[model samples]
Target: MTLTKQHVRDVVDIYIRAWTKQDPDLILSIFTEDATYHERVLGEPIATHGGIRDYWQSKVVESQANIECELLSLYVDGETAIVEWEARFDDLVRGIRKRMREVALLEFDGALIRSLREYWASETIG
Candidate 1:
């Protein structure tokens, strides 16, 4: 099935909500039950909702990182999409603010994301 603009918009909204809230339930709502998530420079891929929940909890919610994202571009073909985005966050762990530009390769199951591989480079901000 072709991925519609509405679908991309919905996914992007969910993505923003997930980061802004850092709520596991809200994050899980954007993914299929058996979805997979990977951050290229990070550790191993998380392949279950429970794993994703834990990952997000430790890395985001528990750390109390405030995140903001800007959607740069989105390209869709069939059930897959590539999204370019910029994110800025306070890294409580490192005691610094950071900015990252990332591209996410996403595979969708209907409106939900089934697989997301994110590639990013982060810079420390003044």
Candidate 2:
């Protein structure tokens, strides 16, 4: 099936909402059970729903606060969507505030993301 722009936007909206609210479950809800999530270009992809949940719990729920995310751009074709976004948050582990620019490539299986690859750069802003 062809991917629609609004469908991609809806998924992205949930993504931003999940991060802003620090809701791991909400984020997890968007992926398939066997989803693979590559948080960085060189990092190993986290496979399976359990792994994804663990990553989000530690990375977002435990280690970040005051999160905000903005969608900079989005493009969708076929079953894939590419999204660019910026985020600002406090890193509890590092005790610093950070701003990040990221681009993610998402491949969908039905309505859920089956695989996600992300590339990003971040700076300590506070």
Candidate 3:
């Protein structure tokens, strides 16, 4: 199926919602069974649904709170979507409030994300 801009937006909305709500399952729903998620530019990707679930469970659900994510911009071409976003959250593990700016490249398999690569920078605000 040809990917539409609205489809991309809907998926992105779900991603933001999942993060803000700290719902690992919701985030996982948008990915393919063998999807690869690159949380950092230079880090190894977390592959497959189970790996992603564990990562999200620990990093997002367990260690982050009061999360907020905003979609700053998005561009879609063929089966790929590139998005820029800003987020603010309390880092439970680090004991600091953080503000992050991120850009992600999402490659889609139909409506699900087959691979995601993220580049981001963050600073402690408090």
The prediction achieving the highest lDDT against the true structure is 3
- Best first by TM-score, ranked: 3, 2, 1
Pairs that collide, model 3? none
lDDT of 2 by residue, 2-108 (tens): 68889889999999999999888999999999999999768789999899999999999999999999999999888999999999999999999999999999999
TM-score of candidate 2 against the unseen true structure: 0.96
Compose the digit string of candidate 3's lDDT tens values, residues 40-87. Answer: 868889999999999999999999999989999999999999999999
TM-score for model 3? 0.97
Q: Which ranges in model 1 have alpha carbons more than 4 Å from their true place?
A: 41-43
TM-scores across all candidates? 0.92, 0.96, 0.97
Q: How do these models rank on lDDT, best leading?
A: 3, 2, 1
State the lDDT of candidate 1 residue by residue for 1-126, as single tens digits: 567977887878888788877878898988999999997637778988998899898988977487888889999888999999998999889899999899999999987889999998999997
Compared with the true structure, the alpha-carbon lDDT of candidate 3 equals 0.95
